[model samples]
Every structure is written in C-alpha cells, then in structure tokens.
Target: MEVAIAAAAVVAMGTGNRVLYKLALVPLREYPFFLAQFATFGYVVVYFSILYLRYQAGIVTDEMLSLPQKPFLVVGLLEAFAAAAGMAAGAVLSGASIPILSQTYLVWQLLLSAIFLKRRYRINEIAGCFLVTVGVIITVASGSGTSASFKSTGILWPLLMIISFFLQAADTVLKEIIFLDASKKLKCGSVDLFVVNSYGSAYQALFMCLLLPFLSKLWGVPFRVLPTYIKDGAACFLNMGSISGCEGAPLLPLLFVLVNMGFNISLLHLLKISSAVISSLASTFSVPLSIYAFTLPLPYIGVASSLPPGFVAGAAVLTAGLLLYSLPQARHFGNTFSQQK
Candidate 1:
C-alpha cells in the first residue's frame, strides 16, 4: 500500500513539476542559464542539507552507499549536458514538439537496458513503448498546428532534443546499474534513494559551476563579467531585483526548483521501490496528464491550452498501452533476463 501511494505521488509530482516549470518559464523568458544553474545549485544545497540533518538523526549513513562516488559524478555530468542541450533545443522546437520528441528516450532506454543492464522486456512492454511513440505523435501532429515541420531545418531541433533525451535515458540506465550493483555488494544491500539524490545533485552542482565559463560564453557574457550576471539572477530570484516588472521573475523559478526537486525525489523513490522499466512507465504516464493540466484555467496559465482533436484518442491509446504493459503476467518476462545472470 505504501509503495502504491509512493508511486502515485511520483506520477502527480512529476506532472506538477513540468506544468509548474512551464509557468516558471513565462517569467524566465530571458534567463535560461540562470534557471538551469539555480536548479542545479539549489538541489545541491537542499539535498545535502537534508542529508546532513538525516545523518545526524541516524536516519541515513554514507556507508550505506559503499559504491565509489565517481559513477554518480559521471551521471551528474551527463545529466547536466543533457539538460543544457535539451534547453538549447527547446529554443528552436515548438512547445508541443519537444515533449513528443523527447519520448524517444523510451526506445533508447529499452535498448540500453537490454545491452548494458542485461534486462529483457515482454512483448507487451515493447508494444507499450511503441504505443507511447504513436500516442505522442498523434497528439503533437493532430494539433491545430504542428510544432515540428519536416521541411528545411525545422526538424533539426526536435531531433537534437531526442538525442539529448537519449543521453538522459542512458543516464537513468546507468543509475539503475549503480543501484543494482550496490544492492548486490553493500551491507544494507540497497542504497537509500535520498543518498543518490544528494550525491548526484551535489556532483551535478559542482560540474555546473565548472561549466559556468562555457555557459556564460554561450550567453555572450565574458568570464569576468559572468559574476554580475549571476548576482543579478540570484537577486531577482530572491525578489530583490530593481526591475519592478521582473521582480516576480525569480519567484517562479524558485517555486519551480522546489517542485522539481520534489519530483526528483519521488522519481528516485519510485525507481528504488521498483525497476527502471516501471519508473520509466510512471514518468511516461505524466506527459498526457501534464498536457491536460495545461488546458485547465489554472493560475499562471495565461492562455489555457486547447486540447487537440486527437488528444482524447491518443490518451486512451496511451492508457491502454500502459495497462497492457503493467499486466501481472509481465513478471514472467523479467525472469528470462534474470536467468541469464
């Protein structure tokens, strides 16, 4: 029952993270790098703070994660690149096209899991992945106007986003390996999810700091002048900016960071309690839901998004695919891969 509740929370939080971030992006229209860095550094500070308190209270110990820290560092670095690239791609791709194309990670995850994690999936699971692609496609393409175009350079950004998400999927698969290995060799047998959250985030924050020069350069700010940009962003983020109009700009990202971190914790919890396949599925469920969320006359949703004609049909098909994939008989398929070990 607890696991079920946690999984449900994961789905809700995951969806909320996205919708809320969209709202945040409204105010953050010109501060993409700031938005990214704030989340990175914010997670580091927030996660490690919780870790410290938990450690003192005897709720967690570093020893539980007997694995070397390097893997998590590598994961963080890859994650940073994936995020930066995805954000860059988003600048070109249509809002509707980005999420749809990003679902390509499902396919990449399956392939990576098969090759590296030695994991196998049932026929239905594979079909479910395909259905996800189809569902997202219908929703995106059947809309009033397609976000991605097939002609000229219109398709390039979506493709880049897909590749970035492929890297993101690869990162998730690698984290799964880390968990599995720790479960096999560590004294507790399974590392705590928060531990990974803390360390992975910390490493990512570190890497982001290291990459600041490059990020600043990309933003056309020189290395020495970058400090002023950071200061200005941090100030506005805290609602201390002189620009009265953008005073609220920082607040949205701050809220976004909090929600996004919660979503991360929920996802890690789901991943820890279940398998990567289930974790992925849980996240996949969030796409349509998040889209539906945007359609409501919610605060900050300046203009409610209209549901495309194919939305219901696509959602129904997606739900069916998820149901088929989650059928209990899928258990047998898992054993085939486990037997290879």
Candidate 2:
C-alpha cells in the first residue's frame, strides 16, 4: 500500500510536470527573456512567502529559515545553467537520436546520497540502479520513431545536450542535499520546504539577471537593464500592451505558467511526504511519459515516424529492465514502512 501510494505520487507529479511545462511556461510569447526569468522567480517567491506566512501564523513551524546559504546558491546556479542549456539543446535537436540521457542523474543522486549524505541502500537498490541504466541505454539505442539517425558530423549538439542534462542530474542531487539539510535543521515541518525552495528561486532569479548582461554580450544582443525588463514584464503581466517590437502575446502561455506553478507545488508536496530518492526515481517515469506525449502530432513537432518491429521489441526489453529494477525497491519500501508502523 505504501509502495502504491508512493508510486502514485510519483506518477502524478510526473504528469503534472509535463502539463505545467507544456501549458504554462511555454506561453508568455512576447516578453523579454529576462522578463520570463523574473516571472519564474516571482512565482517561486509567492509560493514560498505563502508558506512562510502560514508558518509564522502557527500553521507551520519556524525552523524553515535554517536553510544553508552557500551550497544552496551554488547548486541553484548549476541547476539554472543546466536547465537553460538543456532547453536550448532540446529545441535544436528535437528529433535527434541522441540517447535520452536524463536518467544519468539517478545514478549521480544515488552516489551523492550514499557518499555525502551517508544514506545507505540495500544491494537491491544498487541492482535497481543498474537495471535503470540498462533500460536507459536500451531505450536510447533502440531509437525513437521520431529519432533522427545519428550523424557523426552533427553529434556535438546532442553531446552537449547529454552533458547539460547530466549536469541537471547533478543539480538535482545538490538540491536534494540542500532540502534534506534544511529539513533536518528546521524541523518546522513541510513549511520549511516551501520557504527554502522559494528563497532558492529568488536567488536564481537574481543570479540570472546579473549574468544576463554578460550573456547578451556573448550572444551579440544589446543588453537591457534589469529594471527595464521588469517594467516590461509587469506591463505584460497587467495585460497592458507589450513593449515595442515584441510579438503579440497570448493568454495560453500564462495559463501554462499557472499549470507549471501547480506542478512545482505538487512536486514539493511529494517531497514533503516522501524521501528524495523516491521522488527522484518517480521523476524517471517522466522520460517515458514525455516520449509518449511527443509521439502525437503537434504544432512544433509532428507525429513520430513509424518504427520497425525490432525497435518495438527493443523497447519492451528496455521497459522490462526498468520494471525489474523498480519492483524490488517498491516491495522493500512497503515492507519497511509496514514494520515501522
């Protein structure tokens, strides 16, 4: 039962994340890039502030303020960069047959948890990791229906995608560490989770703004002042006219932003209810879900090309590996929770 609930939470979070990204974050069409960044940060701040206020009102504990400063900021920057780079790469290599590399983070998380956090896993857990790795390799190697055949000359783009995504996993591990530390120190219940996350978002927003000038110069674009960007963003937020030269904006993207916010909230709630390891593992399910989602005909990318029977067979084998890995952990988690109860 515990396993079922955990798995359900994972699946729900995964689905929510997909919806959020597709619906919310993708919308805001006419805003400056920096404005979008601020919006993202503002959303986080609002969410966290609500939690903190609740805590102060005796609805949650106050220890939420104990979040570590340095490590959290450092990890946040890494995560931000990874995210930005990966998004760019995904846009560039939409249907390329580069191995779906995000799961590499699972291995990194497991290792970091074991080494620095002193978290121990049974042999079965290790076995689960191995199976997941194999599954990833199989899934990638089999190639998706939409997958572009590998080209030696054009490999650099996909390779960069893999590297950025690997860094994303590393960021995930670091985030988990920060969250775990804050949780342990604050003991103010789940309220602290929201607070820490919100502050982290704020930090990332500031960091991005500061770095934007340099990035603009590098890309050979004129740098806009932060305040100017914010003013333009606020106008967009207020439903006023967009800045000059900006394309007309739509409401759908704003709706998507709300959806993304919900997704983040749901994810944090899951984290409050469960271990980071479980949350991380559950997130892996997203890759498969995303593949399935992208298979449909859409505005940006059309339906995936049909695959041969061999590819289908390979996919099944890969899925079997994933199931083999997760089953043991699920069973063990159930038994452990039962004993504790």
In angstroms, give how far residue 307 of model 1 lies from its true place: 1.0
RMSD of each: 3.9, 5.4
Best model per lDDT:
1
Cα distance off (Å), candidate 1, residue 2: 4.5
Total clashes in model 1, counting residue pairs 3 or more apart in sequence or in different chains:
0
lDDT tens string, model 2, 223-317? 75645655665665445674443322345445445556655665555555664566666666554555555555534233454443344454454
TM-score of 1: 0.89
Compose the digit string of candidate 1's lDDT tens values, residues 1-341: 66578778878988989887887766665566677777777778888888878778877766864569888988898887887678667766666666677678888889999999888888878998788778877765687365325343376667778879988888888888888888888777788777788888887777777877766666666789777877876666666657344535656777788889888888888777776667777787788888888899977657898888898888888878877776555224644733220
User: Residue 236: error of model 2 in Å?
Assistant: 8.2
Please state the error at residue 59 of candidate 1 in Å: 2.6
TM-scores, each model vs. reference: 0.89, 0.70
Candidates' C-alpha lDDT = 0.76, 0.57
Q: After superposition, how far is residue 284 of candidate 2 from its true place, in Å?
A: 1.7
